[model samples]
Target: MTSPYPPSTSISPSDMAAGAKKPTDLPQAQIDAIIRTKRKAREPKACYPCHARKVKCDRNLPCDGCVKRDHADLCSYERPSKKRAQAFESPAGASTSSAAEPTEYYSYDDIPSRVKPENTHPGPDHLGVGGRVSIARDEWDNVRSRLKEMETTISSLRMGLERAEESPAVGPDSGSVQSAEGASRSKGNSPEREGIHAANTFGKGTVHLGSRSVMAYILNNKSGSDQLQALLEGGILPKLGLDNESATYPFVDLWSSDMSSFDISAVCSALPADGQCRQFFYYYRDISGAIYPVIEDITKFENDLELLLAKRLEAGGVYREDGDQAQTPFGTSIAYLGLLYAVLASGCQSSDLGSKERELTSQVYVCCSYQCLRMTNFLSQPTIEAIQTLLVIGNVLSYNMNPGISYVLLGMTLRMGLALGLHVESSRFSVEERYRRRHTWWSMAWQDSHFSLSYDRPSTTAVSQPNIAYREGSQPGDFSYFETLCKVISLALEVVRIRMLSPNAHITFSSFQEYQERIRQIMIEAKPYLRDPQYCSSSTEHLERVVLKLHSSYFCSELCRPSLKPSAGRADANTVAMRKDCVSNLVTTVDAYIELHNISYHAARSWIALQRAISSAFLLAVVEEAKSDSHVLTALRRLEGIIAQRASSERAYDNGDVATSNITSSDQGMASYDPVTGATNPRGLSHPLSMLPLLRDLAPNLKLNGPNL
Candidate 1:
């Protein structure tokens, strides 16, 4: 598929949906049959729980055997509990209370009258299992194919000062070979070099060049998102009780500012009108090294861009004298790493941020979660993808499949969310209204048809000032939220993490299956809550405006809207020089997302904040290993400063009476980091810095909030 492959010749799987039968308006008798099928559990497979309890032999079986035999009272097959369960069968026809709890299901009256079907959803744990045949593992080759489509998107990057066609803002000339002493001097000894050169020799110790070639962009075109949307909007999903309201809208923004500001004119100043700048667009990379036609210059530009990214991260937006503007989702998820190329391809570069601390770590997860959440909403609350994304990045997943990272990261986010009191203690929506709002967040983000409630905290407890990693260059857990918001983070992380075992791997596979079983139990128990069908209608106010995020389609279809498709318009020989800045722009654009995610989401959670800090440390190791990814290191240092300052700021605010409940609940919500203004004013931006000077000045101002911004 990565071969600039031809289109497929198969019918859309949805056009012939496997079970798109049984008219929308079914007879009550048909409903009754399905309902009866659900109410009366199937013979053997359904009897395991009861058999484990060592109950009587009447079984709900032989078609009403339990009901016929007075053992109906013991026929507890309805609802399941999520928190705990596991008991063994005994030889005698007696049972013990070793089982966690009896099954729980929605009572007939508990369900909404609007639902055409009765209370027959088998509660949560055993959702949609009956009256439906399981698809074979091979049957899901379509999903694997979709994943293959995703796999074509991997790439690696490097950083440093290098030779340029013209004098770049940073780095000495590469082809102008340096003598040993000249190279040995660090940043202070020479204005032309830094403490960086000790590592950036490009293939000696750390800076290993790409061994071979493998870079390709294989676009995906086979998603059934439109049909899924149709199903969702048509109430088909709600009808199936798959309509769960999501508790969060990850990014605060709707539309990312368009690319109206970019200018490719300057490169024309030195160009011969050849298409080299344009030709670099189609290149791909594999294991073997494939040099970009524009790499010599573009790579240096990447270093320059990191300086810009630092400013943008501090400034909270981009500003270009040439009018090139780039934007991203505020709480960018993991997939936003794709922006690494998008920006690079646009001829803009970004910072290295060491390895893990930047947007690639946080934003990558954000993007992955965003996509996975949407994918889950499309498929039935499948928690596996988000888990896998987190697991793959840092498989610190331990025996229970819970990563210490997950614990720290998720716990941090939850704590911050609580302490920030983001939507807490207000004249907030009632349960029903909150459910509706959650539905919009879910629809926009995940297309989920269930899971209507936010991760709930128990009754209002007097919150204490939590602990944080407030010091400069602190490791994880440096925020005040880490101690208080434990339950929320622990549970959410537990849910997202347990499903991420690599079944194909030797260590995690068997346990992975067990994890799957555990998740099956948890989700089934949580289904009734997630599949809250009270939210059957799509008439909520946010519904019309909420655009559901879906997987991008490479092939053209009216159903999918086009994402960023920039034309390096009218490139001439000089566009190469100008395009050199593209790597920098890409870096800034990306780090902007990273900074935003850490600040906006993870920063709120103490544990997650600390987890991110640890990731940042590891990433710093990666950067140190690479030796010369200076921009990345600079970005990381800048980020560390930003994080410390924010934490300190929040710690101060939290210490103040304003963080207290007695101050009047009306003003409870407090920003740990000052809100970003999305400042467009160039005055708030670097007015006009010389390329060389701007490159040299990497000192970031964490407290300098833009006035106009």
Candidate 2:
């Protein structure tokens, strides 16, 4: 190709071929190269809109091209990124630097061209992959467009921030609103000041925030300042650092504080007639008393009671059928009366009396007991009478009333016993006193731990300090059974303490095995007592032992249940085996409880046994797999039979068909009623153990039978 313009030396091809004058000292090769080069095209310099539209733009504030189209304001000569970068950079100088020259600030329309350094480029799409700088044109354009939009948005934000910074600072006269600096300087800002500050800063839109921007603004504002202030002003908030729940409702004394003496005569008048009282008393003595040896000297109490009853019945030859008395014929001491009332109430519960009659009679006894308790200074020191009374009342409430309430009373009993230093073994006390204290402590501990387990909470009983073990040859009759039961209970309590009480307790296979081993040893120690040569011959004794053994197995089941629960991570083979063991134990427990009802079908029932039976049934029912097992189904049916029988009796009573009660001749007391022994006829027996509140809650589920039923 030939050059359009002549080079430094003009040499036409024809002239060069002719070798006519050498063109001004230029080499022939250079002349030819220059002539062959073509001129490059000029780069475009129009705005994107005009360029895209292919229109000629006379670039102006309102370009001629845009003005012609009636969209002059849309004529943006300023590139988006440059305009945004100027806005962002402008704010810092305006807000932060007093000495910044006004001219140094660039307006949006006057954004200076930024010089990018040589070899600088945006990051590659894939660095070093085939040494590529490859990017599709559309993608590169999209990225550049997004970058410009982000810059513009950021600049707008900076401008808003600059305006906010220029807003008036809160002054001392700005109502109750304190400056941020002042609020911080103050030792403690009362809730009032904090709330006022939040209102002034946030409520008034001091940050010049839009809806989208206000979220970050509000979150960064002082937290809960307004609510705290309101609570404080209302005096509903506790003092700083106090537990909110405990402070909200202060403790109120359960016992009344009148301290005035109660009329023993009035309380006695509330008691049933001599015959009825004797019936309740003798029933309690033989049945409940035998189980919990709360009575200090049973022989002397019987002798005194017999004499009092005989005199009361004679009553100067009045021969009154009602035997209504204005005063008690027996003792007037508050402790004795309290003990008597508690005994009567518990006995009535265990009797064959109709539900309405039992409830009413028991209530009267409970009131009388309360009256005597209020009159006496039982809490001053531990007395044999106080221990006996507390135990009886606690047992009554446990079996027939709310277990939660019973649990609370047990806590009180434990606290009272501790107050008397029952936990600390003492030689200063008599042998009888020491023994009584030991039993009392164990009773409270046993009750607390058992209920605690059911509640899935920690027991109040602390095994700190010196505790007494049952002395050999000291236990009368099957009292040793209770001792053994306590041992099992203690072990169960320890398991509960480890697994439930400890906040972060982890149950490992080794821990599970260790507990299983310990419980097994305890069970072995208890086995002989269950079939003790001393009481094995007596059916009543044997039954009591059976009940004890059943509870022992239940404790073992409880100890194993935690290990069986599916853990958070991978399953351990050992855990699976332990779970099988747990299920087997649970099945065994259900069988044992069900067998009790079968053996003593129409006998006086123990509330503890009922509770254990119900719990075991529930345990089986809950395990989805267990529902299909024949053993579980059989246990559930037996439990259903027992519950249905009780419900029928209750329904009969409700229908005023009291004569149809299941409390027949077969519904004998723990011991046979013998006139020679001063033992009264037994009524429908109630248990001494509190029924778990869970039973009532689980009623719907318990009533829900599987297909087998």
The per-prediction tally of clashing pairs is: 79, 7
- The alpha-carbon RMSD values of the candidates against the true structure, listed in the order shown, are 32.7, 27.0
Measured against the true structure, the TM-scores of the candidates, in listed sequence, are 0.17, 0.55
| Candidate 1 clash figure, as a count | 79
Compared with the true structure, all predictions reach lDDT values of 0.25, 0.52
Q: State the lDDT of candidate 1 residue by residue for 24-138, as single tens digits.
A: 3434434444454456333243332344333333332331334333344444544333222334344463355334224544432232111122355433222232332222345
How well is each residue in 1-709 modelled by candidate 2, as lDDT tens digits? 9989866644466544544455444444333333423223233355544653556655545654555454566677445554555667665454433333123333332333221222546342222112223334465567669879997886688667546644544333321223423232222222211222322221221111111111111112233223333422332111111101121111121243444644555555566777777878766765566555566466877776677566545665232334564334353355776788898887787566666677667766876786776666666755656766877777666555345346556677777777888778889988777777777777776666666554445666645424545654634333366666667667766765554333334466787678778766655655454755364655445556667757777776665554433232226677667666766777777666555544443223555555555555555544545655777666666555445555555557656775675343232333433322434332343322112222333334445453323
